[model samples]
Target: MKLAKHIKSALAIAAIGAASSAQALVVDGVTWNPNALNDFSATDAMYESIVSNIGDVVSGYSLVTQLNGTASAVFCPGCELTMTFTGYQLANVTLMADLVTPDQYFFTGGTINIYVDSTPDADFTDPTTYGDGILFLSLAAHTMGNGYTLISSPTPQVGNTGNGTGYLDVVGGSAASNFNTNKYGFAYTGNTAADFLFTSQFQLITNDDGDPVCLSSVNDSPICMQGANTINGNSIPEPMPLALVALGLFGLGLQRRLRRD
Candidate 1:
Protein backbone atom coordinates (compact mmCIF):
# COMPACT_ATOMS: atom_id res chain seq x y z
CA MET A 1 0.00 0.00 0.00
CA LYS A 2 2.77 2.38 0.93
CA LEU A 3 4.59 1.59 -2.31
CA ALA A 4 1.43 2.25 -4.28
CA LYS A 5 0.89 5.60 -2.54
CA HIS A 6 4.48 6.66 -3.24
CA ILE A 7 4.11 5.63 -6.87
CA LYS A 8 0.99 7.77 -7.26
CA SER A 9 2.69 10.74 -5.68
CA ALA A 10 5.70 10.39 -7.99
CA LEU A 11 3.45 10.19 -11.03
CA ALA A 12 1.52 13.25 -10.00
CA ILE A 13 4.76 15.17 -9.67
CA ALA A 14 5.93 14.07 -13.08
CA ALA A 15 2.69 15.13 -14.71
CA ILE A 16 2.89 18.51 -13.08
CA GLY A 17 6.42 18.99 -14.33
CA ALA A 18 5.47 18.12 -17.88
CA ALA A 19 2.54 20.50 -17.88
CA SER A 20 4.59 23.36 -16.53
CA SER A 21 7.42 22.84 -18.98
CA ALA A 22 5.09 23.06 -21.97
CA GLN A 23 2.92 25.85 -20.64
CA ALA A 24 4.44 28.72 -22.60
CA LEU A 25 6.14 28.83 -26.00
CA VAL A 26 8.67 31.62 -26.57
CA VAL A 27 10.39 32.69 -29.80
CA ASP A 28 12.50 35.76 -30.49
CA GLY A 29 11.22 37.46 -27.30
CA VAL A 30 7.62 36.95 -28.41
CA THR A 31 5.28 34.79 -26.31
CA TRP A 32 3.06 32.64 -28.51
CA ASN A 33 1.04 30.98 -25.78
CA PRO A 34 -2.24 32.85 -25.62
CA ASN A 35 -5.44 32.00 -23.82
CA ALA A 36 -7.51 33.26 -26.77
CA LEU A 37 -6.73 32.89 -30.47
CA ASN A 38 -5.18 35.91 -32.20
CA ASP A 39 -3.80 36.82 -35.64
CA PHE A 40 -1.00 39.30 -36.49
CA SER A 41 0.59 40.44 -39.79
CA ALA A 42 3.08 43.08 -41.05
CA THR A 43 5.13 44.04 -44.14
CA ASP A 44 8.36 45.90 -45.11
CA ALA A 45 9.08 47.67 -48.40
CA MET A 46 12.18 48.87 -50.35
CA TYR A 47 13.31 49.96 -53.81
CA GLU A 48 15.71 48.54 -56.46
CA SER A 49 16.11 49.76 -60.04
CA ILE A 50 18.59 49.98 -62.93
CA VAL A 51 19.51 53.39 -64.28
CA SER A 52 21.40 54.81 -67.34
CA ASN A 53 22.48 58.44 -67.74
CA ILE A 54 23.26 60.19 -71.02
CA GLY A 55 24.42 63.61 -72.36
CA ASP A 56 26.84 66.24 -71.00
CA VAL A 57 26.99 70.04 -70.65
CA VAL A 58 28.99 72.23 -73.07
CA SER A 59 29.85 75.91 -72.34
CA GLY A 60 29.71 78.57 -75.08
CA TYR A 61 31.34 82.07 -75.09
CA SER A 62 28.14 84.03 -75.87
CA LEU A 63 25.30 81.73 -74.93
CA VAL A 64 24.56 79.71 -71.78
CA THR A 65 22.43 76.58 -72.29
CA GLN A 66 21.61 73.36 -70.30
CA LEU A 67 22.03 70.12 -72.25
CA ASN A 68 20.08 66.80 -72.00
CA GLY A 69 19.62 64.40 -69.08
CA THR A 70 17.79 61.46 -70.63
CA ALA A 71 17.89 57.92 -69.20
CA SER A 72 16.18 54.54 -69.86
CA ALA A 73 16.31 51.20 -68.04
CA VAL A 74 14.42 47.90 -67.81
CA PHE A 75 12.93 46.90 -64.46
CA CYS A 76 11.49 43.70 -63.00
CA PRO A 77 7.74 44.04 -63.44
CA GLY A 78 6.69 40.89 -61.57
CA CYS A 79 8.63 38.07 -59.92
CA GLU A 80 7.94 35.33 -57.42
CA LEU A 81 10.28 34.08 -54.68
CA THR A 82 9.60 31.03 -52.52
CA MET A 83 11.33 29.59 -49.45
CA THR A 84 11.00 26.20 -47.77
CA PHE A 85 12.08 25.72 -44.14
CA THR A 86 12.71 22.24 -42.76
CA GLY A 87 13.04 20.90 -39.18
CA TYR A 88 11.77 24.19 -37.69
CA GLN A 89 8.92 24.39 -35.18
CA LEU A 90 6.52 27.33 -35.38
CA ALA A 91 3.14 28.48 -34.02
CA ASN A 92 1.29 31.83 -33.96
CA VAL A 93 3.63 32.59 -36.84
CA THR A 94 3.87 36.20 -38.09
CA LEU A 95 5.14 37.19 -41.56
CA MET A 96 7.79 39.95 -41.43
CA ALA A 97 9.50 41.94 -44.20
CA ASP A 98 12.46 44.33 -44.34
CA LEU A 99 12.11 46.22 -47.62
CA VAL A 100 14.95 48.32 -49.08
CA THR A 101 14.85 50.59 -52.14
CA PRO A 102 17.04 52.96 -54.09
CA ASP A 103 17.69 56.53 -52.89
CA GLN A 104 15.81 58.29 -55.71
CA TYR A 105 12.80 56.00 -56.30
CA PHE A 106 10.18 54.27 -54.09
CA PHE A 107 7.60 51.54 -54.41
CA THR A 108 4.80 53.24 -56.32
CA GLY A 109 2.11 50.51 -56.44
CA GLY A 110 2.30 46.79 -55.67
CA THR A 111 1.28 43.99 -53.39
CA ILE A 112 3.23 41.64 -51.08
CA ASN A 113 1.53 38.28 -50.82
CA ILE A 114 2.30 35.66 -48.11
CA TYR A 115 1.43 31.96 -48.04
CA VAL A 116 2.09 29.24 -45.44
CA ASP A 117 1.27 25.54 -44.94
CA SER A 118 2.11 22.40 -42.91
CA THR A 119 1.73 19.83 -45.68
CA PRO A 120 4.61 17.36 -45.53
CA ASP A 121 7.01 17.27 -48.49
CA ALA A 122 5.19 20.19 -50.08
CA ASP A 123 6.46 21.86 -53.22
CA PHE A 124 6.15 25.66 -53.94
CA THR A 125 7.17 25.68 -57.59
CA ASP A 126 4.63 28.03 -59.22
CA PRO A 127 2.67 30.75 -57.39
CA THR A 128 -0.33 30.54 -59.70
CA THR A 129 -0.74 26.78 -59.25
CA TYR A 130 0.75 26.29 -55.72
CA GLY A 131 -2.20 27.68 -53.75
CA ASP A 132 -2.89 25.39 -50.81
CA GLY A 133 -2.90 27.38 -47.57
CA ILE A 134 -2.75 31.14 -47.82
CA LEU A 135 -2.63 33.01 -44.52
CA PHE A 136 -2.84 36.60 -45.71
CA LEU A 137 -2.54 38.71 -48.90
CA SER A 138 -1.84 42.48 -48.52
CA LEU A 139 -2.10 45.47 -50.86
CA ALA A 140 -0.58 48.98 -50.72
CA ALA A 141 -0.68 52.19 -52.75
CA HIS A 142 2.14 54.58 -53.76
CA THR A 143 4.34 56.08 -51.01
CA MET A 144 4.40 59.61 -52.51
CA GLY A 145 7.77 58.79 -54.08
CA ASN A 146 9.46 58.21 -50.73
CA GLY A 147 12.77 56.41 -50.80
CA TYR A 148 11.70 53.63 -48.42
CA THR A 149 8.69 52.23 -46.56
CA LEU A 150 8.14 49.94 -43.59
CA ILE A 151 4.82 48.19 -43.12
CA SER A 152 2.99 45.30 -41.37
CA SER A 153 -0.22 43.67 -42.47
CA PRO A 154 -3.78 42.35 -41.39
CA THR A 155 -3.34 44.47 -38.23
CA PRO A 156 -1.72 47.82 -39.06
CA GLN A 157 -2.49 47.24 -42.77
CA VAL A 158 -0.60 50.33 -43.82
CA GLY A 159 2.91 51.47 -42.85
CA ASN A 160 4.27 55.03 -42.69
CA THR A 161 8.03 54.63 -42.70
CA GLY A 162 10.31 56.06 -45.39
CA ASN A 163 13.45 54.05 -44.67
CA GLY A 164 12.19 50.77 -46.22
CA THR A 165 12.26 48.99 -42.85
CA GLY A 166 9.12 47.76 -41.00
CA TYR A 167 7.54 44.89 -39.03
CA LEU A 168 4.17 43.09 -39.01
CA ASP A 169 2.61 40.58 -36.57
CA VAL A 170 0.20 38.43 -38.57
CA VAL A 171 -1.48 35.02 -38.34
CA GLY A 172 -1.28 32.28 -35.69
CA GLY A 173 -0.72 28.59 -36.19
CA SER A 174 1.23 25.48 -35.15
CA ALA A 175 4.54 24.13 -36.40
CA ALA A 176 5.05 22.13 -39.60
CA SER A 177 6.47 18.62 -39.41
CA ASN A 178 8.59 16.45 -41.78
CA PHE A 179 11.69 17.06 -43.88
CA ASN A 180 11.43 19.97 -46.36
CA THR A 181 7.85 20.30 -45.25
CA ASN A 182 7.15 23.94 -44.37
CA LYS A 183 6.99 26.33 -47.31
CA TYR A 184 6.73 30.18 -47.70
CA GLY A 185 6.15 32.10 -50.93
CA PHE A 186 6.57 35.80 -51.85
CA ALA A 187 5.18 37.53 -54.93
CA TYR A 188 6.31 41.08 -55.74
CA THR A 189 4.95 43.66 -58.22
CA GLY A 190 7.13 46.63 -58.94
CA ASN A 191 6.14 50.09 -60.21
CA THR A 192 6.13 50.85 -63.94
CA ALA A 193 9.45 52.70 -63.94
CA ALA A 194 11.44 50.80 -61.26
CA ASP A 195 11.72 47.48 -59.50
CA PHE A 196 11.32 46.94 -55.76
CA LEU A 197 14.26 45.72 -53.69
CA PHE A 198 13.75 44.10 -50.30
CA THR A 199 14.27 41.13 -47.94
CA SER A 200 11.82 39.15 -45.82
CA GLN A 201 11.83 37.55 -42.33
CA PHE A 202 9.45 35.31 -40.35
CA GLN A 203 8.81 35.14 -36.60
CA LEU A 204 6.78 33.16 -34.05
CA ILE A 205 4.83 35.51 -31.80
CA THR A 206 1.51 36.36 -30.18
CA ASN A 207 -0.56 39.57 -30.71
CA ASP A 208 1.63 42.64 -30.27
CA ASP A 209 -0.77 45.51 -31.03
CA GLY A 210 -0.88 46.39 -27.33
CA ASP A 211 2.85 45.76 -26.74
CA PRO A 212 4.88 45.51 -29.91
CA VAL A 213 7.99 43.26 -30.13
CA CYS A 214 9.41 43.46 -33.61
CA LEU A 215 12.20 41.45 -35.27
CA SER A 216 14.45 42.38 -38.16
CA SER A 217 15.24 38.85 -39.33
CA VAL A 218 14.44 35.27 -38.29
CA ASN A 219 17.00 33.48 -40.49
CA ASP A 220 19.33 30.99 -38.76
CA SER A 221 17.32 31.51 -35.59
CA PRO A 222 16.10 28.74 -33.27
CA ILE A 223 12.71 30.38 -32.89
CA CYS A 224 9.41 28.94 -34.24
CA MET A 225 5.73 28.87 -33.15
CA GLN A 226 4.06 25.52 -32.45
CA GLY A 227 1.28 23.74 -30.53
CA ALA A 228 -2.48 23.94 -30.01
CA ASN A 229 -4.16 27.39 -29.57
CA THR A 230 -1.64 28.82 -32.02
CA ILE A 231 -1.58 26.29 -34.85
CA ASN A 232 -4.77 24.17 -34.39
CA GLY A 233 -2.65 20.99 -34.14
CA ASN A 234 -2.17 18.38 -31.46
CA SER A 235 0.92 18.79 -29.37
CA ILE A 236 2.74 15.49 -29.32
CA PRO A 237 3.23 14.42 -25.73
CA GLU A 238 6.00 12.02 -24.74
CA PRO A 239 4.79 8.42 -24.56
CA MET A 240 7.03 7.54 -21.64
CA PRO A 241 5.63 10.33 -19.53
CA LEU A 242 2.07 9.42 -20.34
CA ALA A 243 2.62 5.75 -19.59
CA LEU A 244 4.22 6.55 -16.26
CA VAL A 245 1.27 8.75 -15.39
CA ALA A 246 -1.21 6.02 -16.19
CA LEU A 247 0.69 3.46 -14.11
CA GLY A 248 0.80 5.84 -11.18
CA LEU A 249 -2.95 6.41 -11.32
CA PHE A 250 -3.60 2.69 -11.38
CA GLY A 251 -1.45 2.12 -8.32
CA LEU A 252 -3.25 4.89 -6.46
CA GLY A 253 -6.64 3.40 -7.25
CA LEU A 254 -5.52 -0.04 -6.08
CA GLN A 255 -4.27 1.40 -2.80
CA ARG A 256 -7.63 3.08 -2.18
CA ARG A 257 -9.52 -0.18 -2.75
CA LEU A 258 -7.29 -2.00 -0.32
CA ARG A 259 -8.03 0.62 2.34
CA ARG A 260 -11.76 0.34 1.71
CA ASP A 261 -11.63 -3.45 2.12
Candidate 2:
Protein backbone atom coordinates (compact mmCIF):
# COMPACT_ATOMS: atom_id res chain seq x y z
CA MET A 1 0.00 0.00 0.00
CA LYS A 2 1.20 3.50 -0.78
CA LEU A 3 1.71 5.99 2.04
CA ALA A 4 -0.79 8.43 0.55
CA LYS A 5 -3.37 5.70 0.19
CA HIS A 6 -2.87 4.68 3.79
CA ILE A 7 -3.41 8.26 4.93
CA LYS A 8 -6.55 8.48 2.85
CA SER A 9 -7.89 5.29 4.39
CA ALA A 10 -7.12 6.43 7.92
CA LEU A 11 -8.80 9.75 7.26
CA ALA A 12 -11.86 8.08 5.85
CA ILE A 13 -12.20 5.92 8.91
CA ALA A 14 -11.68 8.92 11.14
CA ALA A 15 -14.31 10.92 9.28
CA ILE A 16 -16.83 8.22 10.00
CA GLY A 17 -15.66 7.68 13.56
CA ALA A 18 -19.00 8.65 15.08
CA ALA A 19 -21.38 6.99 12.61
CA SER A 20 -22.68 4.24 14.92
CA SER A 21 -21.73 0.77 16.05
CA ALA A 22 -23.94 -1.06 13.56
CA GLN A 23 -22.46 0.69 10.54
CA ALA A 24 -18.97 0.38 11.97
CA LEU A 25 -18.68 -3.28 10.99
CA VAL A 26 -17.87 -2.42 7.45
CA VAL A 27 -14.93 -1.58 5.23
CA ASP A 28 -15.80 0.71 2.32
CA GLY A 29 -14.29 1.84 -0.97
CA VAL A 30 -11.25 -0.40 -1.51
CA THR A 31 -9.53 -0.59 -4.90
CA TRP A 32 -6.78 -2.72 -6.47
CA ASN A 33 -4.89 -2.24 -9.73
CA PRO A 34 -2.13 -4.54 -10.98
CA ASN A 35 1.10 -2.81 -11.85
CA ALA A 36 1.97 -5.28 -14.59
CA LEU A 37 0.18 -8.12 -16.32
CA ASN A 38 0.55 -10.07 -19.57
CA ASP A 39 -1.67 -9.76 -22.60
CA PHE A 40 -3.46 -12.66 -24.35
CA SER A 41 -3.62 -14.00 -27.88
CA ALA A 42 -5.40 -16.65 -29.95
CA THR A 43 -4.94 -18.41 -33.26
CA ASP A 44 -7.20 -18.40 -36.31
CA ALA A 45 -10.45 -20.46 -36.26
CA MET A 46 -9.90 -21.30 -32.58
CA TYR A 47 -11.79 -18.54 -30.76
CA GLU A 48 -14.35 -20.92 -29.30
CA SER A 49 -11.81 -23.41 -28.09
CA ILE A 50 -9.80 -20.59 -26.63
CA VAL A 51 -12.76 -19.30 -24.67
CA SER A 52 -13.61 -22.71 -23.26
CA ASN A 53 -10.02 -23.41 -22.38
CA ILE A 54 -9.58 -20.06 -20.70
CA GLY A 55 -11.01 -21.47 -17.50
CA ASP A 56 -8.01 -23.77 -17.37
CA VAL A 57 -5.87 -20.71 -17.30
CA VAL A 58 -8.02 -18.91 -14.76
CA SER A 59 -7.93 -21.87 -12.42
CA GLY A 60 -4.15 -22.16 -12.53
CA TYR A 61 -3.37 -18.82 -11.00
CA SER A 62 -3.81 -17.25 -7.56
CA LEU A 63 -3.73 -13.78 -6.09
CA VAL A 64 -0.19 -13.04 -4.96
CA THR A 65 -0.36 -9.89 -2.81
CA GLN A 66 -1.98 -6.52 -2.28
CA LEU A 67 -0.44 -3.20 -3.25
CA ASN A 68 -2.26 -1.45 -0.39
CA GLY A 69 -4.25 -3.41 2.18
CA THR A 70 -5.41 -4.12 5.76
CA ALA A 71 -6.33 -7.14 7.86
CA SER A 72 -9.86 -7.76 9.14
CA ALA A 73 -10.52 -6.42 12.60
CA VAL A 74 -13.64 -8.52 13.26
CA PHE A 75 -14.71 -12.02 12.34
CA CYS A 76 -18.08 -12.83 10.79
CA PRO A 77 -17.89 -15.53 8.12
CA GLY A 78 -21.14 -15.48 6.17
CA CYS A 79 -19.57 -12.96 3.85
CA GLU A 80 -19.38 -12.98 0.05
CA LEU A 81 -18.90 -10.55 -2.78
CA THR A 82 -19.80 -10.11 -6.49
CA MET A 83 -16.87 -8.37 -8.17
CA THR A 84 -17.45 -6.73 -11.58
CA PHE A 85 -14.68 -6.41 -14.10
CA THR A 86 -14.75 -4.07 -17.03
CA GLY A 87 -12.80 -4.38 -20.28
CA TYR A 88 -12.17 -7.98 -19.40
CA GLN A 89 -13.51 -11.23 -20.75
CA LEU A 90 -15.90 -13.06 -18.43
CA ALA A 91 -15.00 -16.71 -19.10
CA ASN A 92 -11.53 -16.63 -17.62
CA VAL A 93 -11.91 -15.41 -14.05
CA THR A 94 -11.06 -16.64 -10.57
CA LEU A 95 -11.30 -15.55 -6.90
CA MET A 96 -8.80 -16.24 -4.13
CA ALA A 97 -8.83 -15.71 -0.37
CA ASP A 98 -6.38 -14.78 2.37
CA LEU A 99 -7.58 -16.25 5.62
CA VAL A 100 -7.50 -13.83 8.55
CA THR A 101 -8.20 -16.88 10.63
CA PRO A 102 -7.73 -20.06 8.59
CA ASP A 103 -9.83 -22.40 10.70
CA GLN A 104 -12.77 -19.95 10.68
CA TYR A 105 -13.21 -19.28 6.95
CA PHE A 106 -14.14 -21.19 3.79
CA PHE A 107 -14.97 -19.67 0.36
CA THR A 108 -17.19 -21.88 -1.83
CA GLY A 109 -15.89 -25.01 -0.12
CA GLY A 110 -12.51 -24.56 -1.76
CA THR A 111 -13.86 -23.75 -5.23
CA ILE A 112 -15.70 -20.84 -6.86
CA ASN A 113 -18.07 -21.27 -9.78
CA ILE A 114 -18.69 -18.49 -12.29
CA TYR A 115 -21.96 -16.93 -13.49
CA VAL A 116 -22.52 -14.78 -16.52
CA ASP A 117 -24.79 -11.75 -16.19
CA SER A 118 -26.70 -13.37 -13.28
CA THR A 119 -27.39 -16.64 -15.09
CA PRO A 120 -25.46 -19.84 -15.06
CA ASP A 121 -23.13 -20.30 -17.99
CA ALA A 122 -25.27 -23.12 -19.27
CA ASP A 123 -28.21 -20.70 -19.58
CA PHE A 124 -26.69 -17.23 -20.04
CA THR A 125 -24.29 -18.13 -22.80
CA ASP A 126 -26.25 -20.87 -24.41
CA PRO A 127 -24.77 -22.72 -27.38
CA THR A 128 -26.38 -20.15 -29.67
CA THR A 129 -24.99 -16.92 -28.17
CA TYR A 130 -22.23 -18.67 -26.28
CA GLY A 131 -19.64 -17.24 -28.55
CA ASP A 132 -16.96 -14.90 -27.17
CA GLY A 133 -18.03 -11.90 -25.17
CA ILE A 134 -17.63 -10.04 -21.87
CA LEU A 135 -20.29 -10.42 -19.16
CA PHE A 136 -20.94 -9.94 -15.44
CA LEU A 137 -20.60 -12.54 -12.65
CA SER A 138 -22.94 -12.99 -9.66
CA LEU A 139 -22.11 -14.62 -6.33
CA ALA A 140 -24.83 -16.73 -4.78
CA ALA A 141 -25.56 -18.10 -1.32
CA HIS A 142 -24.69 -21.74 -1.68
CA THR A 143 -23.06 -22.64 1.64
CA MET A 144 -25.71 -22.02 4.27
CA GLY A 145 -25.72 -23.23 7.85
CA ASN A 146 -26.54 -21.91 11.30
CA GLY A 147 -23.22 -20.15 11.42
CA TYR A 148 -22.47 -19.16 7.81
CA THR A 149 -23.89 -18.06 4.43
CA LEU A 150 -22.73 -16.32 1.25
CA ILE A 151 -24.16 -13.18 -0.39
CA SER A 152 -23.44 -11.50 -3.70
CA SER A 153 -24.92 -9.62 -6.70
CA PRO A 154 -24.06 -9.01 -10.36
CA THR A 155 -21.79 -6.20 -11.38
CA PRO A 156 -23.39 -3.67 -13.72
CA GLN A 157 -21.99 -2.75 -17.11
CA VAL A 158 -19.25 -0.15 -16.94
CA GLY A 159 -18.05 1.35 -20.20
CA ASN A 160 -17.10 -1.87 -21.94
CA THR A 161 -16.62 -3.83 -18.71
CA GLY A 162 -19.07 -5.17 -16.19
CA ASN A 163 -19.40 -3.87 -12.64
CA GLY A 164 -19.13 -6.57 -9.93
CA THR A 165 -21.17 -6.30 -6.74
CA GLY A 166 -21.35 -8.61 -3.70
CA TYR A 167 -22.63 -8.87 -0.11
CA LEU A 168 -21.43 -10.22 3.25
CA ASP A 169 -23.51 -11.35 6.22
CA VAL A 170 -23.23 -12.68 9.73
CA VAL A 171 -24.87 -16.03 10.20
CA GLY A 172 -23.85 -16.98 13.74
CA GLY A 173 -21.72 -15.86 16.70
CA SER A 174 -21.14 -12.27 17.95
CA ALA A 175 -18.71 -9.44 17.23
CA ALA A 176 -16.13 -10.93 19.55
CA SER A 177 -16.23 -14.46 18.17
CA ASN A 178 -12.64 -14.14 16.93
CA PHE A 179 -13.84 -15.95 13.85
CA ASN A 180 -13.90 -13.55 10.93
CA THR A 181 -14.01 -13.44 7.13
CA ASN A 182 -11.12 -11.09 7.07
CA LYS A 183 -9.16 -13.77 5.33
CA TYR A 184 -7.01 -12.73 2.37
CA GLY A 185 -10.04 -11.45 0.46
CA PHE A 186 -13.62 -12.47 1.32
CA ALA A 187 -13.65 -15.85 3.05
CA TYR A 188 -15.11 -16.66 6.50
CA THR A 189 -17.74 -18.46 8.58
CA GLY A 190 -20.61 -16.95 10.54
CA ASN A 191 -23.69 -17.95 12.44
CA THR A 192 -27.07 -16.24 12.38
CA ALA A 193 -26.61 -12.61 13.42
CA ALA A 194 -22.86 -12.94 13.82
CA ASP A 195 -21.05 -9.69 13.21
CA PHE A 196 -19.04 -10.22 9.98
CA LEU A 197 -16.32 -7.76 9.26
CA PHE A 198 -13.99 -8.10 6.23
CA THR A 199 -11.28 -6.11 4.64
CA SER A 200 -11.23 -6.26 0.83
CA GLN A 201 -7.61 -6.96 0.04
CA PHE A 202 -6.73 -9.81 -2.27
CA GLN A 203 -6.46 -10.93 -5.86
CA LEU A 204 -8.68 -11.30 -8.97
CA ILE A 205 -7.01 -13.65 -11.41
CA THR A 206 -8.05 -13.94 -15.07
CA ASN A 207 -7.19 -16.72 -17.49
CA ASP A 208 -5.77 -15.14 -20.56
CA ASP A 209 -4.90 -17.41 -23.42
CA GLY A 210 -2.79 -16.33 -26.31
CA ASP A 211 -5.33 -13.98 -27.86
CA PRO A 212 -5.22 -10.56 -29.42
CA VAL A 213 -6.97 -9.06 -26.40
CA CYS A 214 -5.48 -10.98 -23.51
CA LEU A 215 -3.41 -10.04 -20.47
CA SER A 216 -0.09 -11.85 -20.61
CA SER A 217 2.82 -12.19 -18.21
CA VAL A 218 6.52 -11.41 -18.44
CA ASN A 219 7.49 -15.05 -18.66
CA ASP A 220 5.30 -15.45 -21.77
CA SER A 221 2.61 -16.91 -19.52
CA PRO A 222 -0.82 -15.38 -19.91
CA ILE A 223 -1.89 -13.14 -17.05
CA CYS A 224 -4.25 -15.88 -15.96
CA MET A 225 -5.16 -14.22 -12.66
CA GLN A 226 -5.06 -10.88 -10.87
CA GLY A 227 -3.72 -11.20 -7.37
CA ALA A 228 -4.34 -9.04 -4.31
CA ASN A 229 -7.31 -6.96 -5.45
CA THR A 230 -8.45 -4.85 -2.50
CA ILE A 231 -11.91 -3.43 -2.02
CA ASN A 232 -14.07 -1.93 0.76
CA GLY A 233 -11.36 -1.63 3.40
CA ASN A 234 -11.84 -4.02 6.29
CA SER A 235 -14.34 -2.65 8.83
CA ILE A 236 -13.19 -2.35 12.43
CA PRO A 237 -14.60 -0.51 15.45
CA GLU A 238 -12.81 2.72 16.34
CA PRO A 239 -11.97 3.13 20.00
CA MET A 240 -12.87 6.81 19.98
CA PRO A 241 -14.95 6.47 23.11
CA LEU A 242 -11.92 5.18 25.00
CA ALA A 243 -10.02 8.27 23.95
CA LEU A 244 -12.96 10.41 24.96
CA VAL A 245 -12.99 8.85 28.37
CA ALA A 246 -9.33 9.73 28.93
CA LEU A 247 -9.88 13.21 27.57
CA GLY A 248 -12.78 13.74 29.94
CA LEU A 249 -10.60 12.85 32.90
CA PHE A 250 -7.93 15.27 31.75
CA GLY A 251 -10.50 18.03 31.37
CA LEU A 252 -11.75 17.43 34.89
CA GLY A 253 -8.23 17.49 36.26
CA LEU A 254 -7.48 20.76 34.42
CA GLN A 255 -10.63 22.39 35.82
CA ARG A 256 -9.69 21.33 39.35
CA ARG A 257 -6.18 22.71 38.96
CA LEU A 258 -7.53 26.06 37.82
CA ARG A 259 -9.88 26.23 40.80
CA ARG A 260 -7.00 25.52 43.20
CA ASP A 261 -4.88 28.23 41.52
Report the number of the highest-lDDT candidate.
1
Clashes of each: 25, 53
Over 47-73, each residue of candidate 2 has an lDDT whose tens digit, in order, gives 111112222211211111222332111
lDDT of 1 by residue, 20-49 (tens): 655543322222232223211112111111
Off by over 4 Å in 2: 1-163, 167-211, 217-221, 224-230, 241-244, 249-261
Question: What TM-score number comes out for model 2?
Answer: 0.24
Give TM-scores for every candidate, taking all chains together and pairing residue i with residue i: 0.24, 0.24
Error of 2 at 237 (Å): 5.0
Evaluated against the true structure, the overall lDDT of model 1 is 0.27
